[model samples]
Target: MNALVDVSFFPRAAKPLASYRKFWAARFGTAPFLPMSREEMNQLGWDSCDVVLVTGDAYVDHPSFGMAVIGRMLEAQGFRVGIIAQPDWQSAEPFKALGKPNLFWGVTAGNMDSMINRYTADRKIRTDDAYTPGDIGGKRPDRAALVYSQRCREAFKDVPIILGGIEGSLRRIAHYDYWSDKVRRSIVVDAKCDLLLYGNAERAIVEIAHRLSRREPIEHITDVRGTAFVRRSDDDTRLGWFEIDSTDVDAPGTVESHINPYQTTSEQAAGQGTTCSKEDQTVRPEPVEGQAEASTSSARTDAGSGSKPLRFMPNPALPQRVGKQVLPPRERTVIRLPSYEQVKS
Candidate 1:
């Protein structure tokens, strides 16, 4: 008889690495980021054997830090992970500097385009630190794509370029929205990436890494649960539009349903007004010259302040009382994620 023993391998937990504060301070002259130092790196045992996460975001361990956890998980799976926070994604140098990654993980705070707006907007939010770059009137350069593609190409000209963050996900369809003073569609189509992973990504990312480790082709690994990017012509035609009875249709004469990620669900497709129930729609008094004003004004009035909501209303999808049969209204194919909602179901 022979005794057998099983040995299991588990990667060590990562510790803090070299302080990122010193680097950021030298570059921007202020700290809007938490410090991650070399000593911390050594304690965390981070080495060159990690994946570089190229993104358009500031690295902070906050609630919006889902991407950070994904990176850490990759490191635990025996891959090092470094973040190129909000790099000049137009250029290739920053991405090249960090070396090639096994996977390029992307994410957005809430929406990808919105994130770009917050960072690149002429009027940006002020940080507690008075001398931050935007406060000093530093805005994102016009060449955002150039920077992103350059770094991406430099690192992995042939490696898979994954576009995931908010900017990439929401723009995964032929969306009609202004960008660089023009409208655009299908971010993956524009970015020319190998794949576009959408929604909360921790689980999908790990599966991607595992599959890649086994030398599997990126295209064949679509069984993982998440949106998968494909060429425009390859999408199913049936996904374009559904001709519901006009009278029974809830949202008519609206392109809102076309771009809504949650258009198909029963609850959403049933069509409801704003999430605010009638009881929750009470108006709050606005203070004017040290006195609260009576609530007799319009229920929806914009304050004279600088902040105003930006709204877009596309033209009617179906014409009224058409005598002849026309083309069915078609929208870009999109898979509804949990975060999606139907403005008109």
Candidate 2:
């Protein structure tokens, strides 16, 4: 087997956030605090917000708060940003307080995870939430990210919803739910949002917001880093890609060596049945049970020396199970996880 290659897949040089061309709406200037009510918007001489932030915490214009940081950052880009902090999630009416977001609704569970904020370490209900005004409790519901996202969808059926913050970041993948004692599906799957931004999302959020401003379809904006979205199992438009079984990565096991798509044309021609000479061509392995046909061209590293291999862990939707037929090995690829049903069991 070829030794793993160390490559810088991302650029070392990045344009500063301040250097982005301000949105045309930047002519409106900035608000002392993002408008929270229609009256405030009216006072600011605005008709509707470009982006509405639905958050579980009170609107404190501080970097410590996820909603504020994102809202202010978008505001700097000349987008009319509004806040719907701690809205009544029981109904969609409260979500309409900001009217409709022209761009999209940015939803977050506040600075901390909703479950951690609402529950005690011993699984007892907490009496107060520090994020709320006056240490108030019950301001936000449990699983605020998912609940708020659902309400946003109901309020504006056509508007796009983007989920973020601690709750979203933590639950981006299948993980054991301490409260329920079971592995829960990705929050992106549960929220049904257009996108879930995980980790430091400043760059991704800025790019997404700008792209949406340009009237780009949200569905087509999947390549951004720090974001996750669900796609059909058979969408394999990506070229020059391959797969690796998860078992090989997670547990040490003997595996067959396959030709790297990034190898030179002479090297590729030397390998059996592998002929991905051009960047557009891909080496497709035989379809295995529950595996999707997703593929992408070899990624270029920052050094620009060689193609960076793309490896994806088996999605929870496609797990390798006992008693299942063993699939043949594929070259230059990674395994996809089992479906939620299989993993939840």
Candidate 3:
């Protein structure tokens, strides 16, 4: 009679059969489709929503890896993150997967400008190129930037859009590009994102998550570290615009005004001569001392002099290019100069 009785388990008490099937797949030859279980996803502690991180580069898990670092950082901060790798930007599926992100994260290749040029040039000239597979031919001049913006606008309305990475940074100003053969201004304006965190955005991203977690209104939260935002200049209405320290240092000025030519004034810059400061998340330019200044006279000149000081711009070659620039003496003043104390502090 006891054998005739049916065994019953509560919904919450029993492990779902799906979990067992996934485990079986893991044990067998098949790669488990979902790497983590539902319980694991819940344990990751996402705030009931996800942060969609769209990247321009291929995805991998390495310490110095930009997307990996940011993704790990976001998860550590209690946000759910879904990565869309090398998105076509032309397709809607990438953005459609996660529904909508609480925050939109972007990253570009170290050679974003060159990469886009190559991608576009390839598309324009190639007739039998089977690499794109099903991709249609009409590529735009600003293909990467436009596709990112359009998808975000279509999929996630009202959510704050943040733009970073190479595609956005080098294009942050009205400058000429060799590949596209055109001049453009800040990507933020063109892409219509609420904010753009240019340069190396790791630390800045963490602070941004912290702020958002606190429920502090995004607009009132000023002086964010390690990032740049566009706003009206103090005097000029239209053309007079630049980057200001998003912290307590409330003065507004041009993009050149906020650049730290020395990069940072902290101990981090001591050995590698790299500087990053928590005081202001913005990175300063590296200091040129001794033999480093060979053939570069602009290093010693005062900003007040008629001649330009050195300024560091992006160099796709260096890992730090995204972090700092090496400017001529005249352009050096375009970004701020960091004091020795600032570097140490």
Candidate 4:
């Protein structure tokens, strides 16, 4: 079953990946393999890599590999990209192999979630990892994203750590862990990383790299889509953005109904005002004070009752209509998701 919440807001126009001016170090040609050691960096004629990528998979120069795709993309944009694959997680020593990144550290748990790669459907520990050079297991620690991020922090106290790949993406929000048999907090909180990029991260990652190169602080770059981060609940006040209660779309309460948009109009009308029994509804957290409420407009009135239907309307606080055209101003808005406490219950 899928859970959803209605969010009505306009995001600013996204800058194209290739639109940003290339970093100053584009003069250094691409490395056949993003360097895993100082020797490789010296061979590539690089004094220091602008971005260092740490992954749990072996270095394969294939597009299928997350590290390769991201590294190559950044290199094309004129940033020195390096790789530290399958570093020993026993201590922070191996993490220091690439020295400190001039921009930030990109950490991923390889192509697969570490837990799934290391375990079986029956929860038995596996003995092989196909992505590894020798098809070996135990190369990456469980929750490799979190472990690697911590190591990066320890290696360079002030460097930013950006977490991605399957592990960080899947666990970006509170999720039930089959192996752990409990709900886990968002990896953004557990890993203590600066940012978490989910799904196809090329767009967000490119923008982030350029912004950081321009010296924009990571904390101030929160409006990017397909990304999640930890911030105080009260942080939205300064932006003057309205909030949408998740429950407005998904009912709050135990045993909530699943809404299927594909259902027939008659089926929807039949289920109206009655709880759905097929799927559980996700609970939304309560709205905080000082946030604007969603707008509403009157739809058709019921013939029998002579009462108008309350329909969701676009936020009037946004760009106003000029004649028949509505133009939205670039602004930052937030869709409030269920709190970690709510999801756990």
Candidate 5:
């Protein structure tokens, strides 16, 4: 009924979630649940879905299921969405059931990582999958995100693929894979998906769907938070990093008990009563670099000299309270890690 909305519609401080105008499909009202097959879609009198979500879990209409949450969320935003859950990955026929989406294909490995779902913590094959309808195992393949992305590409070669869910997000970059017993390259690079949305992607996904509906290219939608994309080899994206040492962070200065430890029970009991004695004291370590002075809040110090820890009572919250914490700027942070080439060698 109204014009479409973009990121700049709302104030910088306010969330633009519900601010976007609803898609024209809002007039179609809601389906009983997101259609799982073309028959269901035909019954709803829909020629094609706006966005089709390909997932490795059964399509439960509950919020607890990742695909359901995403599907309903987009539906609420007025987009005609469909689901292709746990489809037979052997052929692209299942993927084409809902037909090609007008916006893009959202692919996820469901709630849990496929490898974790198919195997136990010890890397033994698992016999059960709680997410599956039958409470059985092997509904989805190992590295389900990669497999599903490839299939989506096969079904609709011109459509953009958006890789998501725990399976893909966890492996966004070169990381160790327990099942394969080795490190693997970034899932986006391997899947060749246009974008990868990580973490709680409600906001990110909503924006992406709307942008795609407006015919914005997914590759150029890189500035959206929570989304990651592979860069062209010619692109010069500079990276910077600063290290935070655990030891340097605020901590209970090391304990140097002035009292003897190998004492008799009688001697220890006697020492407990004399809490005010100066001989029964602890000392503070030198201040951490950049810290103007050592923390004295947890210990009593002599007024005359530098921090002379009279007694040490650790304050667990010291780390949060003392440091000049600097959060990396959003949309510009770059993590530095060893290249897969070096790590493999």
Candidate 6:
């Protein structure tokens, strides 16, 4: 999470989320709640929203509901934000209900990944949706971020589409799709979204919104930390970061392997150093790193030049507590993960 990391696409925010100049709409004050319908938008004396968030959960104006906090934050920043919650995905008319947004369409799959929310870890269909108002099932499509983004694009072809939330954030890169049993390309590519914001977009959203409001092109706003977008091989980004290719970061050690999918439930639990099995859990967890990634905190790695293996000091508890930290060149550096083509092959 960029909020936790000291470096990335950029360092942690030096500026506060609210410190930015408010948008022109901030003079209207915060809405009773983010407008969800044309009637509500009219009631708020608004013709168009600055940002419209499409979510798969019922509109709840509590801080516990993430979208609520985001809406209020934007409102505090003088942007009129609207919510399109759990709309009928069969058509694009519902998406057009809020009319076109003045800035961009923000899309999410709600509190949980759509596939996990609608199905059990064992891959069985679920009969109820916790996020749905009535606890009714099938309120969202299997891949809600993709569906909502596509529908938003259909509703307003010219408006930029930005995807966030756990679903889009986790899938921002090529990763194993346990549901599909294949490596899927980044969600930005699959959704054809102009940008994908990952891991706590508090800083990224505020910056991007302000820039877009000033008529800056979304395609040119690639420097925002924790956001991902596509670029052709020949595109001259002129980015000033050092990208370390990490494809060879680790050797194929004897112990490196995915846990046996066919193992007894008990065996799987023991291997994970947990007494409880993850299989068929009653409550699904918020998204986290995949279970398949190898742990490197204590693992010795011989940097790929035939040198002796060495253990890296585990990361500090807090990024700010850089107590006795060593130095590397001040060049902004990031790990260049395997390409989508490399992953698929």
Instruction: Residues 234-313, candidate 5: write the lDDT tens digits.
Output: 34432332223334444455557576878865577566774444554456576775564545532335554565556656
**5 against 6, candidate with superior lDDT:** 6
Name the 10 consecutive residues with the lowest summed lDDT in model 6: 1-10
User: Candidate 3 lDDT, tens digit per residue, 30-145?
Assistant: 22121122343345433324456665444565555466677765655555666655565666666665555655544443225424444555445432212222443223224465
lDDT of 1 by residue, 167-272 (tens): 6556665454543544454555556666666766565666666666667877555445554555333334234423333233333443554446856444453466
lDDT of each: 0.47, 0.79, 0.48, 0.80, 0.78, 0.80
lDDT of 4 by residue, 1-345 (tens): 111211223365767887889899987766677888999899998888899999999989998888999999998898999999999999999988878899999999999999999999899999999999888899999989999999999999799999999898888877999999999877888898888888888888898999999999987877777777777555642365445545554432234568897997556866785445443344656655433232112222235458777765665555443454332333554556776788999
Query: What is the clash tally of candidate 6?
Result: 1
| Candidate 2 residue lDDT tens string, 146-198 | 99999999999899999889899889766789988899888887888888888
Tell me the lDDT of model 2 at 75.
88
lDDT of 6 by residue, 1-345 (tens): 111111344555457875798888878887787899999999999989999999988889998787888888888899999999999989899999899999999889998999999999999999998888889998999999999999998899999998899998788888999998999877877898888888888878888899999999986886677777776544555355455556533423234567787898777877887656456545777545654234442243434446765765543552332344443344455566777788899
Ten contiguous residues minimizing lDDT sum, candidate 4: 1-10
- What does each candidate score in C-alpha RMSD? 20.0, 18.8, 22.2, 15.8, 12.7, 17.8
TM-scores of the models, in the given order? 0.48, 0.71, 0.48, 0.74, 0.69, 0.73
- Residue ranges of candidate 5 with Cα displaced over 4 Å: 1-14, 235-337
Report model 3's TM-score to 2 decimal places: 0.48
lDDT value, candidate 1, whole model: 0.47
> What is residue 85's positional error in candidate 3, in angstroms?
1.5
User: For model 4, what is the alpha-carbon lDDT of residue 312?
Assistant: 57
Off by over 4 Å in 3: 1-48, 104-111, 114-142, 232-345
* Higher-TM-score candidate of 2 and 3: 2
